[model samples]
Target: MDLLTARIDLDAIAHNTRVLKQRAGDARLMCVVKADAYNHGAQRVVPVMDASGADAFGVATLAEGASISELTAKPVAAWLWVPGQEIPPGVELGVPTLDHLSWLIDARVNAPLHIKVDTGMHRSGLRESDWEAAFRMAARAGLEVKGLMSHLAVADDPANPYTDAQADAFRRAVALARQVGLEVPVNHLANSPALLSRPDLAFDQVRAGVGLYGLEPIAGGGSDLRPAMSWVARVLAVKPLSVGEAVSYGLTWAAPDNGFVAVVTAGYADGVARSWQGCLDVAIGAHRYPQVGRVCMDQFIVWLGDNDAGVAIGDEAVIFGAGGVGATELADRVGTINYEIVCAPTGRTVRTYTGGTGA
Candidate 1:
């Protein structure tokens, strides 16, 4: 079997969820397991989340919501809706616009639904101009209005005033719903950053997205999160390169000194993005080594310096996770966010889960 794997610490996830819940105080925790729990494998994340007291699970699509609802008894809500996607039997849906409500009414969608308000983000939500029509139409159709939700544009930045403004607007929108005779039970506008920084925004529940997976949504928030996913592969071969010798593909990187190279059976095809070639480092146990040469589709070369490198075939090379190259560091080096780094590894790599209620 391929040695490349993404070992997940479900315990860390549970810990993070608990911490987030603690931060939220009285608000229920909505573990956003969308994008396959940001590619941490929702198949493994959902059950453990329930064990950790997650009030609900948030997914991005109807299919994802349906998949998880079949696995756990907790409520699963799909926030983004396309016109024809099948709304699963009990899965809550995020109703964004009058058109979405129209489709829900036409399809006879008889599940819990939250109204998305476009208070300030101008994203997918009911507009201020369309709120009355949406509320009235939904009421006319007897659609149960379970909650009122809005997406924040700058909740991640503590210095941004938009969070306050958005929260106020969200409240105003909810008040408008009340005026229209709709009882909006759950009022949620907080994502991870908002939950960690602005507890006032956590009305009924907070959608803890990347934060639950131990990747911080805010710059300093990672200090509280334990990285849940680790990427690793085993060394396939070790060899020495002469001072002037070039390395893999187009000779992009060459041996500056006499260095030993360990070829690991993991590369872009395995979710190690090609852009990581000249920039990323992998860990052998706790020792870090620079990756040389252009990363291949199936393998990459790590330059272990001199004889002290002491690496051999069959040794594990950790790409990122505990005691290894962390996802946050890799994200900074790659000029992207940690969300992509953790979600990078696909199912092509083996997933070994550890540390949780299941443990």
Candidate 2:
């Protein structure tokens, strides 16, 4: 095992999915496995996901959809940010592609296709008037209208009124698609936050990404889902520091008093953000130590204050996950979001999957 490693709780993932399914109630879930399952290792985590009764899987790219098919041979549906020209392999393996009206005819695969509407999130999808044409083209191209979906820009913010408006727009698009003679079986427009905060947006299928990982995207974080990823690193060295001594770069942090400081083997290069300087804290055994300086490429120092002895070289310092610190907590401390925390981890770090309730 590497000194710095990410422990993936496979059982926690299964548990989280089951919890989300329950919360979603009547809504079918297309588990968003995009960004490599939010950096939890999509390929490695799919078995547990399958065992947990996932209705379907969603990814951001066709490559990811292909990866999903390769891993489980399960029905994988993907919403690509790019247009139709960038489609990848394995489209015949029951993976659905999503795009705007212009690219509707480009989805030449045998599987059903989805039409993405730009409801409010100005990122992807077709405009309102173009949606009907898009569905018409897809139907003519022999593509089954699996669903009509859109992304929410501010579903996590309860105060944001745009959520309802977006839901309404999605409904109108579905109505238009059905008018065009397409079987608009599923209509989805909810991400993790929307799924958690707005029950009304739970259409036929809800796409959840962050919630499955157990980090609340909504305000004042805490969700019904359990955390599935835990990052741990070893304390490589411990040094005695005087009150006036500064730590890391630019002298950003100074010891409060004479105490021991432990240098951890992981840093920004390992996904600990640079903004974590002097603000982040890690748990070693039962004690919490403050991050004392700017996170370096591969290392950071934690101020031990006046305590010592229990924490030594090789002692595990937990960054986030079950039986550990929360990513939401770290993101809040660093003035970022849970999504950044989930993606910040570098690929070099070793991952160990701890099988939970499922085999």
Candidate 3:
């Protein structure tokens, strides 16, 4: 069996959901479970959401939305699209452009729809100039536009004015839609960062992704969100290393005279990034062990610091968890976002979930 494992704390997910719901206040919470709950395994996370009283869910594709729909009867919306795609029944679709809107209108898809407005993100969405025409056409075509939504370009930073500007633009788009006689049942513009930083923008619903997993969307900040996923592995060997002995691919790391090197059953293929070498450390029981040398494709070595560090071959090594070495710390070590760090592990790595009403 693969020694590498990812432990998901279902209770932590539920706690984060409750925290997010509180932050949302009067606005409904739409848990964004895209990318398999940021690689935390949505099959397990979505159920936790169902029990947590989430109003709905938002995903990147129809497949994700459909999968979530199977888990719960709550509303599920898919935002991404192909030129011609089949949106499953009872699933809401996000219209990216006016042309796409026309296609849905022509098809007479009676399913609920959320309109994406470009606002200031300049990414994907219907332009402000086309919102009136799109809304008018949708009304004429008898399409059900349930929500008006937009993405936050840079809300992670509490000081960034771009998010504020985007919020304003989104409001204007919604106003134009109303003026054109389109009934927008809900107006949503807050992602995780915006939801936490700007409670005022949590109009009708808040799309929270990373925050639900206990990883902060903002850098070096945000509320008390606990990380729900923990990457772990078993120590396969514990060997003595002389002060001058080199290790791994580049032989870049040398043992400190009294220290020993530990072999862990995980590497780049298991979602432990290669860049983690020399920087990241793992928790051996309650102690910390520093990773040495280059992380290999199948395994990596850790420095026990001393000969009697009390670690053994069968001991568990926590790469990151709610305690000890955490996801936020791991992300910083690799100069990447916490989202990418938590999502790094692969299917080859087994996932074991704990806590919540059900496993």
Candidate 2 residue 347 Cα shift, in angstroms, is: 4.6
Off by over 4 Å in 3: 220-222
Per-residue lDDT over 94-140 for candidate 1, one digit per residue giving the tens place of the 0 to 100 score: 98878888998998889999989898999799888898899888778
In model 2, the runs with Cα more than 4 Å from the true position are 81-108, 357-359
Give residue 70's lDDT in candidate 1 (0 to 100): 86
RMSD of 3: 1.5
lDDT of 2 by residue, 63-148 (tens): 78878888775567776545445555544222223344435455445556666788877776777867766777766776776787
- Residues 195-249 of candidate 3 have per-residue lDDT tens digits of 8889999999999989999987887765888889988889999988878898998
Q: Which residue runs of candidate 1 sit more than 4 Å off their true CA positions?
A: none
Residue 216, model 1: Cα distance from true site in angstroms = 1.6
Error at 100, model 3, angstroms: 1.4
- What TM value does model 2 have? 0.90
Question: Candidate 1 clashing pairs?
Answer: 11-355
Winner of 2 and 3 under TM-score: 3
Per-candidate local distance difference test:
0.85, 0.77, 0.87
Candidate 3 displacement at residue 6 in angstroms: 0.9
lDDT of 1 at 163: 82
